[model samples]
Target: MAVFWIQPATFLAAYYHYFHGYGELIASHAADPSYEVALPGLCQPLRIRDFPSFLVDTTGGEVGKLVNDAFRELFEFMDEQGHGAKFLVNTFDELEPAALAAMRRYLDVFAIGPLVGSSAEARIHLFDHAGADKKRYMEWLGAQPDMSVVYVSFGSIWTYSKQQMEEIAQGLRQCGRPYLLVVRKDGRQEDVSSCLDDAVLKGQGMVVEWCDQPAVLAHPSVGCFVTHCGWNSTLEAMALGVPVVAAPSMFDQPTNAYLIEQCVAGVRGERNGNGVFAGAELARCVELVMGSGARAVEIREGVEALKGMAREAAVSGGRADRNLRSFVTDTTIH
Candidate 1:
């Protein structure tokens, strides 16, 4: 019947970033022979190495459960299928050939990349509205010099505990740079302001619940981006030619971080043991990236190169374009 299974990028990406914590546990289970009988095809019995990290976590509370469920639901579907279905992950062949290979037996699998690119483009257009929101981001950017401000955001889903938030503030305080932090207003205002309670951050830091991201990144003052390594955010940063401090909270973030830091030389942040980092570490990462003289220059130049490459990739005969075309063709073919 050819049931084509699609892996959600949001789900898979989350798995790539946070899977660090659960690897050992999953690996252990994979070593046990009993796993095959206990969970049947589910593979939880195998070990930590075989499973994504989310399944092994106990710390994120309900949010952790939600993450667990995301992966769970996908596997559950596979288990229910009589012969299973073809699986398609929302990724690029260049990015994750190994995982695609491993899952091939489960079903026919293909990787299509950066699906959120168009979505981000759509969001970018939304900034065209000339209203209070645009004015705030623009005016703020206007006041700063070129490449002077650091734009910091945690993507749409990452939420910090109160203590973590304060630590971030302290780190920003220590960095001694002009910054804008976009944090959701969920009773976390106190934690956000604790570091600035005195005049240490006067006229240096601004906190907004949300801001026009594309506008902010395009601003002359925005020298670097501190981000969660979400594909959309990463692409936007690259498109805007801003170096990224890739602090990936979970999922494909680690993979993304590897690309940015190792391949592109445009990122400067390390994932901690569990794929999560402390606020102090985040601060150090930011300082190294934002305050870096030579590294910053290299990053800016590298970003410019990527922008050129992105343009070529979009052209009719460009590598990216062809890859995209092949992606579509693969998805449609038998």
Candidate 2:
């Protein structure tokens, strides 16, 4: 039986870009994980590491098998359907033209998103189960000076290693700015808490179990976002014009980080010898995005420009709006 899975448009584009919109290339490149490739719109060449795990992982396991199966199934379905199958991707046309163009060569693909905007009202309840201290967090944010707070969250799914959490705690201490960090109530709650010294964070930082992420991103005090580079979070941050300090965890994260850097809107936090983001590296990334310098100014300006485009696309008569309406009309007719 064929299984199905969904992927972000940007990440899906990385697949198309690497395969050159052909399945044959995927079969041919099965041997070389180290080979370099480039997408039309991006400047930096990508290796297998920059793509999704299932695309590169040779480690045979049940998880790998399921993901690989789904990937193959997706391609087969697309190929079988040909131009008759319409793909309504949750990405705005202005955001990823190269990827969209690549897919449209064979499929009826529409770039109708960054769809978390008001028009689409994309919402997820994953964070709700965490019992976030919303009142305290919101009040704290309200009290902070404009553009002074650094908001950090790695989405709801991932739980960091104790060492990584310790490194993050240490980095935020050294970050030299007020930061609001979300430590989920998953198994690693104590791991993060144990690493964080209350003395260091006293009156300077706040670590809550959860917060309304969209609200935090939109807050005026939030200047820099330390994110896992999830697509939805990426869009939210971009739309609000908050500069990102990319600490990608998995899947589409690395690609989104690359996208952020390519757009001159952020810097990726460099990993240490252990392939973990060291405390110093985290501090450096935060400084690059939040510091008062030419580069920081440019990054902020870059994200602001993207913010305008994202809002424009969500509004009536915009590309996202038009494409969405067209899809609805076409589907209704069919």
Candidate 3:
């Protein structure tokens, strides 16, 4: 009955009956209650308003009702179950100490990840990029100056509208920096390259259908990431010491984005009334993160500190390893 989940622990808490004998791994930073607490160094507490329209209820429309109904069912299931479940979160102690501590008050929680493959043999990419020319991309990256290129991708899912894509294109042009933008062939209506001429993209940027994200982020040329703030992407960027420009859209992305911004490791782009972003706003966020000013320096410092912590946690005999071993021992004993 061992289960690995990316959803909130509340959903896991509801289905404890399914995991009576074995353990469950819940991968997230904040629990349901921790979101309510005023984070120590954050500018403001995270609220429902911070979430995208699909996740929160500000306007009373049919779509909003459907979203609310689904959430209501989820919580109702948890409430009826009556007790909380222990969690093995895909986060480390140093990253979210307060949220982890707060969750521990209610459940037996352990922090044991940046949960990525340590060896090349263990790497498992869900998306097939066998056709991609890794050497070519790496060579391009190698030619660029250290900490000079912006890497942009929004994960595998969550398609952006053509308008949104255009805005991002325009924003990148405005930033006037070297970039590698991964636009999924299936996610957009028109070819992104067609919209932006060869002159704007050829020397200044590289647009690929897909590429090895970790490799790109780890490259010395990648100074900042324009990300959707998915937990895996967030952790990877942190581990690599790459500052972020968060353009979170839905799910736990908003929470991750808030945390990144609060920790001074990134800046969040402003979403318009419809949760869409303008090119100007995106440019502003990118400039803020990529600039050599005081705030950017602070962000780089924070990301570097987190990167060290992530490396230490993943090493043998580190805190995460010890915690994982303890979990295994306890499970075997029982």
Best by TM-score: 2
Highest-scoring model, lDDT: 2
lDDT of 2 by residue, 106-223 (tens): 6677677666644212555665544566779889999999999989888878787888888888788888789898877673734555675551466898878777777888889998
lDDT string, candidate 1, 1-334, tens digits: 2333244332343243234254444444534423421222222222232223344444456865786676656655655663335444545444344445445544555554334343333554422233236567668778988887878888766776666566667667777778888776553534555544531376887776667677788778998888877767776776667888877655555445655764364664655565455667767766666665777677777888766655554456655456556546665773
The full ranking of all candidates by TM-score, starting with the best, is 2, 3, 1
TM-score of 2: 0.87
Q: Which runs in model 3 stand beyond 4 Å of their true positions?
A: 1-44, 50-55, 58-84, 118-121, 191-193, 198-202
TM-score of predicted structure 1: 0.65
A best-first ranking of the candidates according to their lDDT comes to: 2, 3, 1
- Assess each prediction's global lDDT (C-alpha) against the native: 0.58, 0.74, 0.70
lDDT of 3 by residue, 125-196 (tens): 667776888788889999999999989898988676867788888888888899898877676766555555
Least accurate stretch of 10 residues (summed lDDT) in model 1?
Answer: 36-45
Q: Residue pairs in steric clash, candidate 3? A: none
TM-score-best of 1 and 3: 3
**C-alpha root-mean-square deviation, candidate 2:** 3.5
Please list the residue runs of candidate 2 whose C-alpha ends up more than 4 Å from where it truly belongs after superposition: 1-8, 17-35, 39-45, 117-122, 127-130, 187-190
Which whole-number lDDT from 0 to 100 does residue 221 have in model 3? 96
Superior by lDDT: candidate 1 or candidate 3? 3
